[model samples]
Target: MPVYKAPVEDTMFVLYDVLKMESYGNLPGFSDAPRDLVEAVVSEGAKFCEEVIQPLNVVGDEIGCKRNEDGSVTTPPGFKDAYKQYCEGGWLSLAFDPAYGGQGLPVTVNAIVGEFLSSANLAWGMYPGLTQGAMAALHVHANDEIKSLYLPKMATGQWTGTMNLTEPHCGTDLGMLRTKAVPNGDGSYRISGQKIFISAGEHDMSDNIIHLVLARIEGAPQGTKGISLFVVPKFIPGADGEAGKRNPVSCGKIEEKMGIHGNATCVMNYDEATGWLVGQENKGLNAMFVMMNEARMSVGIQGLSQSEVAYQNAVAYAKDRIQGRSLSGPKSPEKQADPIIVHPDVRRTLMSIRAINEAGRALVLWTALQADVSHRSEDAAERQKAEDHMGLMTPIVKGVLTDLGFDNAVKAQQMYGGHGYISEWGMSQFVRDARITMIYEGANGIQALDLVGRKLGAHGGRAVMAFFNEVGTFCAQSKDDAALAPFVGSLSKGLKDLQAATMWFMQNALAKPDNAGAGSTPYMHLFGLVAMGFMWGRMAKAAQDKLAEGADERMTAKLATARFFFEQLMPESSVYLARVTAGADSMMALPAEAF
Candidate 1:
């Protein structure tokens, strides 16, 4: 009843033409990678997701995940086999280093591959995607012996990984966390904590589930500074690398949720589990962020994936379903009515989704490029700038794109009219699944607070300023490029609007502390919109330059997409600018007792 086709052309355009990611091929660690390999991998990956993984979408959501009384969780009817297929196809380690049985692909290409995989079946796709994040964290923080023990199998996908940070009483505020760990003198700790909302927590899809958990050590500091990370497995591995004995890890229950029914969200109980410290003692929270950043970016891909699937379904429905007369008179008199696509509002909705998705895709891909630069650049200053850009852009990737992705989903459902609300159309699933994105991975509101309260003040806001200056320099270099004028003009306006909103928020937050919280979400989104618009404009500039030197029709399609983005999506900033500049009075006027 539903269909999705990977936007392979668009993906190629973003990877090769827009970001020009292969430019990094000259960098020391990345010298082995170039455009041809990038193209070959993404193309093959897209086809694999389309033919193998996507066929499982409906099956996954319908079958969901079931919990057994014996502390184990069963994945959707065929998830075990599907994930096995995924792992066997070498997808699990596409971006990992080659030393651990991975392909050592550039992360930029991996991001595109992730987008396609998720678009096909996000519910099932989340399993490996989240595991990749866990693997990355442990790889960064785990000691050599522990890494040798777990990383190889997890990277190869014989085993999987899960994150355990949230508990029943705590969601975003880790400061109130009650998870505890006690030292066991022989270079290990015993971890005991109840973690809620653990995705892929205790599933039977892998030989074992490796859990990277957060808990406070004995006599640790009272707040966030005391939190430490531990590696706790479901079953202890014997000398033969098999899970021989059941560990003290078990699932209390699986959450019954609105969407992502295919993926298990568990309430986990860790009872004095044997644990190994991944990083420095009492500095675990800082170490775990290695995984958190990766998780947050993957969540951003989920947002885009959700948007792409919803857009595809809605577009198909609009083209085929004919119930209304044309507004410009009778365009379909032979049939009794016209297709919904003939209507202006329907056109607007579809265009909005298309534009946001395309712009959002560009922003996401560019960030991935920066992420590669942060890790692989040869020069120290270049690496520092890349790291700064990655830090500043991470929240936007998580906060703004996801927010728009959900909006696109809602518009998609609206496009289907009442049919969208009914489960069979499958439109509702997009909205429901996308909702969790806003709440988790540090709620978008919190991301804004970090942007203004922390990142903005980081390095004296010079990181963000460098970002703005780069955008300005790009515009200056491209003003003479004829085909890019419209996108550049719109982007220039959006940038000014964002700059104004930033100045207003800075003044307000200084004058009144409450102003920061009240303006947080709006400010975050405003920044996100302007940031994406900047990317879109750069895309137009690149496409225009290529055209001046001579490109084919495919390049024209990009120009058209750039035009559509400027005309439609950039206007969103006006709305957020007002909300951001609204001051604290509007939000704080209501007393706590009024409710």
Candidate 2:
């Protein structure tokens, strides 16, 4: 079994030391998250996930979920018990609104807990994870009656949730979905359709499953414009808002997937299920986007989660496994050979994984804080800026982190040689699970397109310009700090590269369009490198401050790792720039008949 120790200390470093969580005390709900309290909550959450949930990871993969003759699904043993404990622990309400039976904490604090759970056991963690997204969507778009009907139970984890959008015919193109909803003449509609690849779609863990679905109404205009969002529960709520009669929703079949075997990714069949519209007529895509964006962020965490676990196991293996003599003289002369850690190549691999994981953690946490500011800030201007930043960074976080995360998992598996390829070591599972993050939640290709296509010019280029200004200001401030010169210098150059790439697209893409499409992926990755570089600079400055204050070995280690990131990892941005600048000619050269 792969061991997973909760990274509580690393999380605290980002939360308090790097981001300064204390300064946000003035915001509503943040006042309750004092350092000691946040630490205690994170510690307790970590203990629960590590002890109660993590052991089920292998079991879930092996046993998977079973479908019965009655069409109900059964999860792996202990999943239900673990979910019960999670609900009783009040975790579902941790970051929700108090008006709906929640504890009303900051989303940033909740995100830390979320990362830990995901790292410990991603498949099991997904049950509550999907519910969190559903709650977020309903909280924003659902009417009062709908909120009253669903939010309370969902907030307490008594009911779980799922998003139903994809059909056999459609994945990314929502305009092609065939799910239908016809008005029943009583302020409700009858939803009828089949949806495939619905994660957490069918399970016996909760009393009811609230599905936020997308379907077209009768005689509406074609495409996504005619689509509408609906809330259709597995069991219809009675006048008292408890699960009553059965709704017409049923699981057609559970997908036999490459990973996340514990989650019931189902093919769902809805037969005239009772449903209510969420946002507005002919605007379901808008309401559904709220849930999609939230899920994308969660998917990005899934990327980081896999990398962290893979890195931990790889570190352990490198220390224990005996290998050839060190290139430098062998320090462990008592043994026949030195440990793999002594090898420069092994060190390079470990450092590469570590550099990305640490910096990725910082980037996600910073964005989570931005989400908090977007939702909690008193100043309208501050909220708008934070919202714009969140919109701009979302695709990069989802795209880059998952792509790197899968690569990191493969590298970790490489460290184990033959054992990594085998099943018992658990490294293969991490890679398989991380694979879906890049595909779902808007495939990384689409994410790249979104970055180049929509986010750059959003609000008259305010978001990207804001990013440039922040990096420039930081580089300027650290010019005099000799200890921080490497990180600042690398990040400054990265910013310039990113700017040049953006300008290239502006100069060439509008007329050709194909030029933009060809370069989107590279440009997305370039943006991600710069974002991670900026984060590393912030972490380096924090580490430097700690060292100046006569801190311990950990601070020294942090500074060294930051230096490794600047020296080894940040240079990849240049390659991405070169690709982006190459444009579409070579990519589109071949004729369709050539294949």
Candidate 3:
């Protein structure tokens, strides 16, 4: 069985030491989340994930979700019970509004919880994850009446939620969607549509499911402009706000997916479901993007979560599995042969995964802090800058983390040799689960395009420019510190590469849009490298500061890992930059019939 132990200490270090989260105590939720409280929450969360959630991972994968003849679905065994425990523990309400029955903690704290949940049981995680995303959308865009009726129930996990966007004919192209909503001559609309790939769409865990669906109102304009969002619950609430009547929405079937079998990815059929508008008419995409963005961030963490678990298992295997003697000599002379970890190639792979996982966690937390700032800060300028950071980093987090996360999983599996391919070892599940993160919540390619095509130029490039300035400032400040010289120097070079790539896109992509399309993926990764390198620099500085006060092995290991990141991973920025500037000629040269 695969084992997952949440890196609670590392998370604490990043939260308090590197990010200095307590310094923002003036913020709404931050005031409630002191260091001790946050530590207790994370530590308890870690224990819950390790002891309760993780044991069911293989069981969930093995049994998957089952759909019954009544159009209702049953999740994997132990999932429903585990989900109940999760709700009673108040995990879902950690970062939500206190007015809505939430604990009112910092979003950064919730983000840490999210990583733990995902790492422990990703399939089980989606059930609540989708609900949180839906609640966020409703909180932001839904009318007061809707929020009052739904947010509290969803907050406490009495009612879960799902986002319904993709139809049978459409995935990314919302304009092509044909779902229609006809006015019922009252406050409600009659919705009729079929949405596929709906995660946590139908299950027995919650009393009701709140589906945030995208549909076009009758007589509305065509294309995406006509799109509008609707709150279609499985059971419509009565005057007293209780689930009184069964709505016409039902699960058609659950998808036979590549992985995450424990999650009920359903084909939902809506037969004139009674629904209410979420925001304004013809502004569905605007409203749904809120949830999409939230989901994208969570999906990015999913990537890291899988990679972290996979790395842990691989490390355990490396230490125990005896293969051959170390090239330097017999390190374990008493044994038949040395452990696989003694080999240089094995060390290289483990270090590579460790380096990225550490930096990736930091990046996730840092970006999540920006989210807290964007939502909670009182200053208008601070909010705008933080919002810009969220917009700019969202795609990078979603794209780069998943892309590398899957690669890391594969590398971790490679450590197990042929056993990794077998189901009993559990490494295969990690690779399979990690694979979906790259494809869902907008594919990595779309994420890259969003970065290069939209986010990069939004608000006249304010976000990217701000990122450049912040990283450049860090590099400049740390240049003179001999201890941080290597980290700062590597980060500086990576930042320049990102800047040059941005310049290339500005200069070349407009003349030939294909150039932008061709270069966008590399640009996203290039941006990710610099962002992670920046994180490493900060972490190195923190480690050095801790060491100055007193020496510690943990801090020392942190420095070593940061060095590995700088030496090995940061240089990839140049390779991606090369790809970014290579242009689209050869890539697009092949004619339609060439294949």
TM-score of each: 0.97, 0.99, 0.99
For lDDT, candidate 1 versus 3, the one ahead is 3
TM-score of 1: 0.97
| Deviating ranges (above 4 Å) for candidate 2 | none
**For residues 1-595, could you state the per-residue lDDT of candidate 1 as single tens digits?**
6778888878777777777766777764466666677677778888888888887887878888888988788887777887888888888888787777777777877788898988888888889987898889888888888888888999889989988899889888887889899999998888888999998898989988899999999999988998989988888888987777888989899899988888999999989998888888888888789988998888888898899999999999999999879878977899989988999888888887887888888888888888888887778998889889888988888988788788889999998889998988888888988887777778888888888888876888878889789878777776776667767778878888888887887778887978877887887888888887887887776777778788887667777877877887788788888887787886777789996
Q: Ten-residue segment with the worst summed lDDT in candidate 2?
A: 565-574
Instruction: Kindly report which residue pairs in candidate 3 clash with one another.
Output: none
Model 1 spans with C-alpha error above 4 angstroms: 546-553
lDDT of each: 0.84, 0.93, 0.94
Position 93, candidate 2: lDDT: 87
Better of 1 and 2 by lDDT: 2
Which lDDT tens digits does candidate 3 get at residues 1-595? Answer: 8899999999999988899988889998887788888999999999999999999999989999999999999888899999999999999999998888898898888899999999999999999999999999999999889999999999999999999999988899899999999999998999998999999999999999999999999999999999999999999999999998999999999999989999999999999999999999999999999999999999999999999999999999999999989999999999999999999899999999998898899999999998999999999998999999999999999999999899999999999999999999999999999999999989999999999999999999999999999999999998999999988989999998999999999999998999999999989989998998998899999999999999689999999999888998889998999999999999999999997
Question: What tens digits encode model 2's per-residue C-alpha lDDT throughout 197-303?
Answer: 99999998999999999999998888989999999999999998899999989998899999999999999999999999998989988888888998999889999
